[model samples]
Target: MKIFIKTFIFLIIIIPLRAYPQACCTGGAPLSSSLGVISYTGENLVIDFSYDFNTMKDLYAGNSQLNDKQRERSTNSTILRFTYALNNKWAITTVLPYVWQEQTVRSNVGKTVQSSSGIGDIVLLGQYAILQNKKNLVLLAMGPKFPTGSTSKTDNEFGLLLPPDLQPGTGSWDGIGAVSYSRFGIFRPTLSLYTLFSYRYSFQVGRYDGQQEYRFGNEMVINIGLTDSFLLKKWILNPSLQFKYRNTQKDENNGSSFPNTGGSWMYLVPSLDIELSPKIYLHSNFEIPIHTDVVGTQLVTSFKGNIGINYTLNFKKNKAYKIKD
Candidate 1:
């Protein structure tokens, strides 16, 4: 009877994990649309807002016999972002997300399930341009991530099952630093290299339960872009490759043991930007995870894609106005 009870508890924990699969990267692509907002800022301060929606589904079979099988799991999320350029060299951005997730499991004994929905983490970031040159190159940006989301709720069955890294509200502070360089090459092709690093440490406070100390291991993202601009045509095509590496760390029930869950991932991202009018344009990109270590054997079977729309409101200066009209 004791053995059966322990097995039942284990199954409960595994079921939710199998259902959610864990979310690694933030929704959409690696590059932020507002990253370059300051570069094009005019008078009156420019503001841009974007919305993205993503949907993912997955099915897994544990063994060859297919006896240990799981049905499909689906997740839908909507993210809204806003950016405001303070000047030509600095800007601030924020993202708010809402997620709806569902899980269904199937076995010889029949089927079991759970589901939940809530507001995800809220991230506030700032960008600063350190250097720029009109003809050849530019270097910019870095910021911090504040814990504005909630973390107190933990549903053992359904609802927003929190990952170790994102527990709704981490109740801790974190910092991120990044630098990107874009250079113009021959044939009008632009080459850009971006590198980013982030770290977060959680304090044992409030409803932290035990002396569980949580720390986000070092995380890095590298992106290389090949972009081309066509003369007279308001269109730009950028094909890029992104590489990500994350080292995991966890400590619970004191400082006895902490296992490492490190992994690397790579994706191919292609983006197209077109100008609809003078300063209005539509941008979109498809990011497909091609290789990964954290995904295990189910890498291909489980993948995510993002689509977003951005609207830029550019500011213009009034040259005719005099100081004392």
Candidate 2:
């Protein structure tokens, strides 16, 4: 039973990331866990607000590093997530984000800054609980990623079409498929473990000028992690650690594929969650790349950080909600 619980928790905790573009690197992998899906409730409505920061400075070609060339990119994203339980076994989630992106590149004319800001792609998912018990959970989720963000944003200073990597949106529709399973108390009652797998399939989109088509490469991610909760007098402290392996296929443009636009990456993430009260929760995560192998030369993220807060409203009149330690 203990081995089964450990294996189960190792596989389910990683599948909760909502699909969205992040950072300046066009091919950067999405965060493995964006919402509190691993720790959730039934018959309750949850609202989450989060902020993400990513910085890019290193340039890599294939597996070799090149000079930075005084080029840098940064992205700041604000996201809102709504999760509603239709009932005990069914739930739906919606995610909306606003992004601010900036890229600085050195040119013969000097250094120039290109930036864009607006709404990003939206994601909707339906979640079903395949199994739920006091110490284990199995879930299946599927979702459609919508192209509600602006793809044709222009840089007024350059008077040219900025590269797709610097855009706020991918401009393509996509689909997400995910599976997760989690188990608790493998070692101790306060210890939890989970693992998850997610895949994002991309559909092509035509540029606003009708001159070319841009398609973000398909993405696959696998994650495994564990968390332990410590009880305080009035506060619950939870710390987590996760490992993620992500791969992205090469992107296509106007029927031609681009190199250096997609590759495989591995990340180590550490996070913390605090339950301030029964209805309020706060979480934060920091991610660092452990290894990266790209198809061609591209800029990669150096580090990423995110923080979020969630508010839960319980509508189960007959049951009193309690925060778990």
Candidate 3:
């Protein structure tokens, strides 16, 4: 029994070290409201947009033996963001997101299969530049997640199961605050640190439904640039590590709860942004779960691959009228 306990602890500590690819979540860097560090000056305006899709299949340890017992999930997300320079001292930014998710579960007896689908919540954020210079920086951001998604269980699984929006989106008023700093060393590459905090309050579920409330946890991330250059002058690589701490929460009636549900994770996440002309570029990353504590008899998930594109639109400056010589 003692040996088993020690082995379990060892697995938990070693799993997150395999260096997963830096996908959107999983092993990637924390989400930032900033477009990236300012490499140029002027009243620059940028409109950044992207789409992401993810799917998970056959989740859980007993799924293989249970025949019909299985779980699957898929998600599609779209984000539209805008940034404007309020002089060199500060800037303002906003992000609008739309998400669609689907989940399917099968019973062990092969007697029943359940599924749900719907839109998720929407979020808005604002950012301020607290400090900026040639080699160091600091920034702050705050935002709210609105209950714009479908909370009605009718949208999913026979009106009996919880919808993805309700299960993951936290159907309540919530706020997020973040602080980030980065520094460049003369002998090496840039290093960055980020911390995020979130708070949520549950809502009353009318008369017939049960009331549920939960307080999520906090997250911290650190990133180190392994190399400042790659493949000549058009590509760069960065490796980073991220840690998440989750607080315990429970179902009031059941008295069952998830403990230490949060764990630390690490990944190599090498990102490449290629310059395809000045207006278009290609970006991609692969995140693999090296270690995770989200394991058990029920289900487990790991990191995967992500690839995408980016386009920049530059408004042309008006040319001076030529006078006859």
Q: Give the TM-score comparing model 1 with the true structure, all chains together.
A: 0.68
Candidate 1 C-alpha lDDT tens digits along 204-298: 32335644554433455555555554434555433444443343333322433333233455566666555465444555555565554542212
Residue clash pairs of candidate 3: 15-290, 15-291, 16-291, 20-288, 21-286, 21-287, 21-288, 60-299
Clashing pairs in 1: 115-159, 116-159, 150-169, 151-169
Per-prediction TM-score to the true structure, in the order listed: 0.68, 0.86, 0.62
C-alpha local distance difference test of each model: 0.45, 0.70, 0.40
Shift in Å, residue 249, candidate 2: 0.4
In model 2, what lDDT does residue 166 have? 61
lDDT of 2 by residue, 54-136 (tens): 88777776666677556677888888888888776777888787888887665443455668887877878887778877887
Candidate 3 lDDT over 207-265, as tens digits, reads: 12545433333334433332233344565333333443322122121233323233344
Residue 280 alpha-carbon offset, candidate 3, angstroms: 3.6
Q: How many collisions between residues are there in candidate 3?
A: 8
Q: What's each prediction's clash count?
A: 4, 9, 8
- Please give the range of 10 consecutive residues that has the lowest summed lDDT in model 1: 316-325
- Which scores better on TM-score, 1 or 2? 2
